[model samples]
Structure formats: structure tokens, C-alpha cells
Target: MKRSKKVFITLMLMICTLSTFLVGCKKNDSKATTKKDFNYYTAEKLKEAIEKKEDIIILDIQVKEEYDKHHIKGAMPTYAFPVKTDEEKKKIDDVLGKLEGKKPIIIVCPRGGGGAENTYKHLLEKNIEKDRLFILEKGQTGWPYEDLLEK
Candidate 1:
């Protein structure tokens, strides 16, 4: 009886330890994937990049009206939604083809948030390199630059 009890307790401890190890590994894996996938640039940093004439493409995902009303100067207006259809994917591919693949791309949306991340994911699905894509930390709303372009 004593030996059986001891064996049971040992088995329980081993199971608990294995579960803890697996949970820790899962957490690390998620963190590593997120770190590997994409990067972010604040509005100020984006402005500086523009000023420096860095070889980057600013891809805006806002609606046409919003884009026409105000957008970062030199930003390409490509409207994108979080959920993409086949036609939308094709459109994105066409736009990407226009740009040099080696150049870094920054995605933006209204209010400096939301749709940009979704667009980033779509870009990844289109096989854009993780290093070459970035999300604007705070979409156009966060941009401090005064000279937003108008239609």
C-alpha cells in the first residue's frame, strides 16, 4: 500500500512538471513569433524618415475620402480592409509590384491604429518579408506633421 501511494504521488509530480514546462515553452514561442513577424514606427520617426528621404514606401489603408482629404505627403493611397477578398488581394499584389521589393514598407490607417495591423498580416500572407514591413504606431491621426496633402 505504501509503495503504491508513493508511486502515485511521483507520477503526479512528474505530470505537473511537464505541464509547467510546456506552458513556459508556449509563452516563449508566442513572444518569439511576434518579435520575428513585424516592426513598428512612431509618427515622429516616420516624419524623420521622410525628411531623410529614406527609401521607404508609406502604404495607406484608409478609405478614399479620408485619403483624399488628408494624408502624409508622398504616401501611396491603397485602400485595404481587415478582411480581404480575392480582388483585394490582387489589388495589393499589383501595388506591391509597383514598388521595389527591397525597399521597406510602412502601413498606415486612420487614427494610427487598427486596420494597419490587419493590413500587415495580409502583406505577410502575400509573402512580403517580415523585415521589410512595418506598422505605423499611431496611424495618420497621430502624425504631427503640418503639411498633410489634400486632393
Candidate 2:
């Protein structure tokens, strides 16, 4: 009876741990807004902004190698893709000054994926108002304006 009780308790503990992990793994949407909730700066809109000389900023979070090969003409190199860790998130601070003012900040990720979203959220947490933050709709990969890219 003692052995059986021990086994049952062990099983219960294991199940509880697994359940906790599963719940933790579930995405916490409260910290980050849905994609639709973000201010999506489409490629066409960016192109028009560039042509019109509007005040805007682009932060490229691609890997250094990819960013070196090509990025938006005036985009700042963050080289902080998948900005997940506390350390990685600090990379955004390096360009915090440039993010000031009413200019819109366009986060340019490889494929308009987590990197961009992460960067956008970090900026918001840093107190930059939502109106000044944007995620490039399709990211640099979907940017169709070849001339606007810098090698």
C-alpha cells in the first residue's frame, strides 16, 4: 500500500508539472497585440512615403549577413532577429534616439514574422506610442521595390 501511494503521488506531480509547462507554452497575447491590431505599413505605402520624403524610420532586424546583402535604403541595422531574450531585446535601445519624435518606425524583419512583432512590442513597452510604431507588412522579403533597397 505504501509503494502504491508513492507511485500515485509521483504520477500526480508529473502530471501537474506537465500541465504547468503546457499552460506556460501557450502564447500570452496580453503582452503583444494581434497582427491586425498593429499598424501595418504596406510596401506600397512605404514606397510612397519614401518618394514623398515623409519622415519615417526603418529598423532592420535581419541577421547581419542578410542585412549586409540588402535592406531598406535608410534602414537601421539592428541585427537582432528573434528578439526573445532580455539581452537580445537590448539591441533596440541602441537606436532608441532615432525612434524619437512623431516619425513612424517600420520594423523590417526577414519575412514579417516574429522578429518584427517582437521589435514592435519592445518599442511599445519602451513608451513609444502606438501611433509611431509600425511593422512592415510583408517585411523586407516582400518588398517589391528593388531600387529602394541598399546593398
Candidate 3:
């Protein structure tokens, strides 16, 4: 083939290759593959929700004894502390499993608590959305609301 014809063919091939790549890159550019779901509520917001009687679940992530002693009113005790027994492990799994698909899960522990934070991380690793999970910053010990339970 002549030099000019050869050059023209090579340029056309390069153009076609570039076009294919560009088309491939352009595919599905109009929509995002993932959507953000869930919302993280601040301490004040959580309090407000509780006061207003909104749809939410308060999770007490502390030792069962501490929970029994004192915890946020209407909060379900979900002991996330170190598990020393199969029954405890089962309880944790049962609690987490139930909360996994449930949104508005508010996690709290005693004031100056640590266990709930670890459990929160675990839940995140288990594919829990950050927004779906919220930590009651001050925990039960500092919670302004009064504990409603029969002593």
C-alpha cells in the first residue's frame, strides 16, 4: 500500500479504538449506582424525637446488669459488652439481626461508656449504614430524659 493510504488506515483504526473506549466510558453515566440512605441524629434531635413520640428505637448497648440498674426510658437492652457465654453471643446476634434491617437504631450505653462504640463499628462492618446507626453521644448516664421504669 502507498505511504499516504497506509497512514490514513492507521489513523482510522486509532480513531475507531478511541471511539470505542469513549463509548464504553459514557455508558451508565446518567445514573448513580448507589444511593445514600438513613440519617444520623444528634443528641438533641434524638431527645426531641423521643419527646415528640416519633418512630424510633432506642438501643441500650451496655451490660445487662448496668442496663437493669439504669437506662434510657423505652430503650431495649442490647448488651454489646464482651461476650463470655454462648447465650450472651446468641442474644447479641438476635439483637443485631433484628436491628440490621431496621432503621432509626439509636445506640447508647452508660455515660462514659465504651462498649456501644465498638458494637457500632461491628455493625458498620456488617454493612450497617452510618446514617441508620447513631450513638447517643452522652449515653444513658448523661441522658437528660428521666428513666421510666419500675424499680
Candidate 4:
């Protein structure tokens, strides 16, 4: 009788543990939304969006030198100034301020090689909703438009 009781308890515990893990897995699978969790779009789609004047911001996160060489017209250069101190943050704010209330701000870099993924997380940490931010999947170089302004 004692051995039987122990087996039953162990089985119950195993079932409970499995149930908890399943529940957690389910929660993870369900996609959650926030400004940081935004999806990256290709440049082709982005151009389409631009033509339609969609509510989005096309941001270039590359070095100014690269930007000066060539970039999509009207795209904002976000990392123009290095953010070394809190004062510099204000500069960032100034740029971000212009983009305030804008949905789906698309972050772009040279071939999508910049620290855009981290920046996206930082923006989310700042309470920017996930839906408000996006990344250009292929980036400026990958943009399929001949309008690429080259240096």
C-alpha cells in the first residue's frame, strides 16, 4: 500500500509539471504586441508604403558618412549624433519627438547591419509600443529602388 501511494503521488506531480509547462508554452506561442516587437519589412514593400503615404517613419541608423554616400530620400538619419551622455539623449529626443505619435517607425541600416535589433529593444524599454516600430529587413542597400542616392 505504501509503495502504491508513492507512485500515485509521483504521477500526480509529473502531470502537474507537464501541465504547467504546456501552459507556459502556449503563452509563448501567442504573439504579443508592443512597439518593440514590430516586424521588419523589405524595401520594396516600404517603397509601396511610401507611395501610399502610409503612417510610418523610415529611419536610417547607419553612420553619417554612409548616409551621405547614399540613402533613400526623405528618410531620417537617426544615429547622426552619438548618444554619449544624457544631454545627447535630448538630441535623440528631438528627432524622436518629430516622430512622436507616428505608427510603425521603420529603422534602417546599411544592409541591415547596424545595431537595429538592439535599438528596437531599447525603444521598447522606453515604453514605445511594439506596433510603433519596424525595421527594414534588407536595409538601404537592399532597397530595390534605383533612386538610391549614392555618394
Candidate 4 ranges beyond 4 A from true positions = 1-38, 80-91, 148-151
Q: Rank the candidate models, highest lDDT first.
A: 2, 1, 4, 3
Candidate 4 RMSD to the correct structure:
7.6
Stretches off by above 4 angstroms in model 2 are 1-32
| Alpha carbon lDDT of each predicted model | 0.77, 0.88, 0.66, 0.70
Deviation from native of the Cα of residue 67 in model 1, angstroms: 0.2
As a whole number from 0 to 100, the lDDT of residue 11 in candidate 3 is: 100
Candidate 4 lDDT over 33-149, as tens digits, reads 343455778777888887788877777767778888777877887653334446544445657666778578887877664356655655676677777777788777787787545
Q: Which residue pairs in candidate 1 collide?
A: 112-138, 112-139
Model 3, range 38-114, lDDT digits (tens) per residue? Answer: 23345678778877898787877678788877776778776766433555445556776667565587877665334
Error of 1 at 39 (Å): 1.0
Q: For each predicted model, how many residue pairs clash, with residues at least 3 apart or on different chains?
A: 2, 0, 0, 8
List, residue by residue over 7-49, the lDDT tens digit for candidate 1: 9999999999999999899988843445345598888888889
lDDT of 2 by residue, 33-92 (tens): 577878888999999998898888888999899999999888889899989888778888
The TM-score of predicted model 1 comes to 0.69
User: Rank by TM-score, descending?
Assistant: 2, 1, 4, 3
lDDT computed for candidate 3: 0.66
Error of 3 at 104 (Å): 1.5
Q: Kindly report which residue stretches of model 1 are placed more than 4 angstroms away from their true locations once superposed.
A: 1-37, 148-151
TM-score, cand. 3 vs. native: 0.59
> Which candidate do you rate higher for TM-score, 1 or 2?
2
